[model samples]
Target: MLRASLLASVAATPFFITAATAQDYFDIGEIIVSGGLSPIEANAFGRASNVITAQEIERRGLTTVQDALRALPGVSVNGSSNSFTQVRIRGGESGHTLILIDGVEAAGGDGEYVLSGLQTANIERIEVLRGPQSVYYGSNASTGVINIITRKGAIGDTYTATLEVGAATTATAFVSRRTERGGVALSFSHLDDRGYDQSGDGGEKDGLERTTINLSGDYLLTDDWKVGFTLRGSDEEADTDPSPFGATDADSYVVDDPDEFSTRDERTASIYTEYEMMGGRLTHRLSFNKTKYKSTYSSGLPVTRESEAVKYRLSYGLDGRTVADTDHLLSLLVENKKDSSDDNPLYAREATSVALEYRGSFANGLDVQAGARFDDNTVFEDATTWNVGLSYQIPDTGVRLHASAGVGVVNPSYFELYADAYGYSGNPNLTPERNESFDIGAEFAILDGRGSFDVTYFNETLIDEITDVATGPGAFSFVNQAGKSDRQGVEVSGNIQATDALNLRLAYTYLDAKNPDGSVEIRRPRHELALGATLDTFGGRGSVSGDIRHVSGNYDSQFWQWPAPTVELPSYTTVNVAAQYELSDTITLNGRITNLFDDDAVDAWGFASRGRAAYVGISAKF
Candidate 1:
């Protein structure tokens, strides 16, 4: 299976590498981005950070944010297809990374992280900061923060559009418009394919459709203060056979029809007000948001579920540049969530949280930040989280030393605390999981920040962990285990711009995870490596790019190994490539190939990955 996935990825590379591209040069580094600070500033001050700008997205020919993150170090991303992607940072679980779109939290009632609602088409840039960030972000940010900043209207009225066709019969269309007053964007994407099978017959196949619409508007309200609104909606559908391992007959194995599997719909609305004063030194913001998520499973009983969430926040900031540049921020938030399941035990949950944060840069090129959060959940008594971090730059050289420590809590999700799905029951007595993490790191920039290296060593300890261990009656329930789970790891990643024509990015991560029960956590890899580069030629008119990703074998469980002693998911590597051509000032063309090596990596117990694929696309501006 691994061989097939690799082979497929390799085979598709030629198409992307052979096309001619235009020299229209743009530097993402120059784009004005503010999640309080620019990406460069954030990277320099934060303990660990990764920035992916819109230009980078286009340069890499990435269709989704998940694909863009896969090449980064210490970030683990997995998906059955484009629509079911999930990401984990370091060794933390997927749900532990908080995803924010335009400063509003995107969470489902089931506590599932909702990255699916973000359309790459509408994003201006993304900042992925690693380590326990609950102090600044609150709650789910125990491991990291993925903040997606949406595009804003600055340039005069203009329109951007793109259409793509690829292997799997994949098709995507995107249209975006920007005016001095407001901006809007829309995208429609679908992928369908006959999959490759490892057992000679009955391989795996899937079909998916995703549609996204986004609207954003800003009225200057006298130049110093402005109020803005962001509204986004998306719907997705998928049909595929359950892993072929579940099929006993070859005919029953092929997903008979591509559109018979599952459906999901999600919508989000947010409004924000911003006022600037004292020469842009003081800023205040208030925001309100509502999100609704619905998912229906074709193969399950009860068949459907819906989750709704409403959240509001107020934030104030003050900037000063006296002795040392400094900023003080305060935020308060309230969240209410309700879920209706065909099986209603996991019915509803409400939570209210508050946080205060302060950060500043000193004259000696030292930066410090700290914050605390207090949360009260109707389910749990109370939980408090806090963190403090510092980064200092050494004199005369572009080297920086960083360190941080934090403690947090993850209140059990609805599924763990009160699910009645299928035949399983939830435990109302579940306690909030307590987590403590610490890290120390350093970064060195050579050749004027064009080439940089960063490394971090980190550790986390979880107490009173919750796990759904088998109890009795053919059901699983969440239990507060007595022992602690500890994980430690090292992450190293770098990018070197050897010359104007060549750029290279490399990353490697090693993890050590274990518990008192002697079981390794599920789906955690011990080692991962990634290498990517872009070569530009034809006077900046043509380019060639490719990436290689590798993951080490991992165990599935602590026990249950008999016939082959813990079936090992073998290590595998996949490659991707893209080429571009400038059709005119308003148009460009691109060709891409994925799984060029045709590696068919298996997932879970029954499903295998898709093989080699090819695609062609065009983008135009008006």
Candidate 2:
């Protein structure tokens, strides 16, 4: 890793540069910040969640969701290419975070679901809930949940367009129209970078292209009922370019045939129906979705996968307001997935799961939520999991308190449970890992509602963890270990309206993350902090904002053996600033400067972050 002192001299030279015009650094509000879990709802629970609205996302001119989360606390984004983003949440593994598209599970292949091969144009809002949520979602919910809400058509005609350009000749163009009856949105984005080093696994420039299309229409079968369906598809291509280090970058460990790099195509179709009564107070929802994927690799490997899911839900409101607007929800889900390869038939899997839940509120301004889920795998015995939570608010002081406890179980994935070739064998005796956790938190508003403080403390115990035993220099075998791990941490965030036109946002996380055997988990940090503020002036027409983030040193891999026993990633903070100017009601100019200090920081051994980059964008609405 680069030292702080050396950053000064390295800052003198630019890492990468390309022509840039206007662009959006941020996207608008989405599901996490909308629905019942708005910023206000999150504040009432005192949980550690940061709500970045769609407007905020657009103002920052960011390219994707992964880019936006990179600026938040307790999140470490490590990946050189946009096609592969690895996010470590609260010291959890990269796949720990559950990502949802409009409340539907968006599973990943080989661990890319965190944020990869996806764009921000169709997203209407994004909600990021920190902490375990297996009670509602199910397995792979160890760390938190990221719910992305997409845009739907309105009654009238509306159109939005955007264009952006940056280093590596990266350019994005998106356009959409919402008509009275239906809507259609299409986007084409491409990134061609000389890359920090060589292209995927090979020393060559890297290139990626993604094209997305979405179509939806609703027909009012009756005044109280409606039906609609959506069709979505995406095609992506990426070239292998290896980073300086081992298999860290997208194209690390270059294969023999560079032309066979990587390519993927996907298609998803869904149908839904909704019925409402009592002026929309009571509702029934149902949907069926199917998706298929095809991929080709340079190593002469070909893959095909298919997934199908069906969901049903029912919700109702209390009869009278005197009962604190009590509401109830029940849902059921089932899924089937299959993976096939011409070279490896034993690597395929067939998985299934079902769940039920009950959630409501009391008249005393106290909230409670609970649920249970069961998963049956074709390869192992079935497992069940559950959790419960409660919250209360003091109106006079604007102080809200919340506490929750739960037990969660996770089933192994296709790659972890079935694969038995390539010099390694799958452990048929692997058992599901179980976790029990509890947490308490509070949030207070001060300075006449302009200032706020939020804090949460949590502890969890994990048992029967799954692990891999290396059998050879290039192969390993999977197995369930008779071990337990414990993690406890506290997260604190505060914001102040220092002035009418200025606001400050800051957050920090402290964790004691380790195994029962007293060994620190690899790649998990003990401390992480982020500080940022926005300066708005001239009646909201112009503003400037910047932030600094620091993460304590950590390991990069699980095995203790390394060039050094423990890789000290070190603690380094980078700054970002942006300014906006409104030229007219139809036109606005936005400019942003990232890595202001030009810190040549390297989180992984030989992978370095880009330094001193800028973009200018113009947005207009007709």
lDDT of 2 by residue, 1-622 (tens): 2222221111110110000100121122111231221112343332345665555666555557776776665566666343456776666666777776655556533233636556665465566766666655556776676766555533344444554445444444444444322344444454443333323223444456666666555555665566666666667776543323344332242322245356777776778776756654455556676666666643346566555666555554455321112344333444444433333455554556666655565567776666676677666767777666677877688888877777666666556666667766767767767777777888788898888887888887777778878878878988777777888888788889889877788778777778767777666667767787788767988777777777675555412234334455656667777777778876677777777887755455434455666766666554
Q: What is candidate 1's lDDT per residue for 1-622, written digit by digit as tens?
A: 1132221211111011000010122333422122222112443354667778766777777777777777777777765443456787877778878776665566554455534323466456777777777655556777777877655433444456677776544454545444433344444544444334422244344556667666665555655566667776667666645433355433334344444466677676777665545644444555566666667655443333444444444444454521112244444445554444444543666666666656565678877767677776776657788877788989988888988888866667667777675556889888777779888999889788789898999898877788877767777778888998888899998999989899999999898877757667656778888999988867887677888888875544312222223445677788989888777777888888888998865433334566788888888766
TM-score (C-alpha) between model 1 and the true structure = 0.84
Output the worst ten-in-a-row residue range by lDDT, candidate 2: 13-22
Q: Note the Cα lDDT for every prediction shown.
A: 0.62, 0.58
Q: Number of clashes in every candidate structure? A: 33, 40
Best by lDDT: 1
Cand. 1 Cα-lDDT: 0.62
Which stretches of model 1 miss by more than 4 angstroms?
1-40, 80-83, 114-119, 168-200, 243-260, 277-281, 301-346, 420-424, 557-565
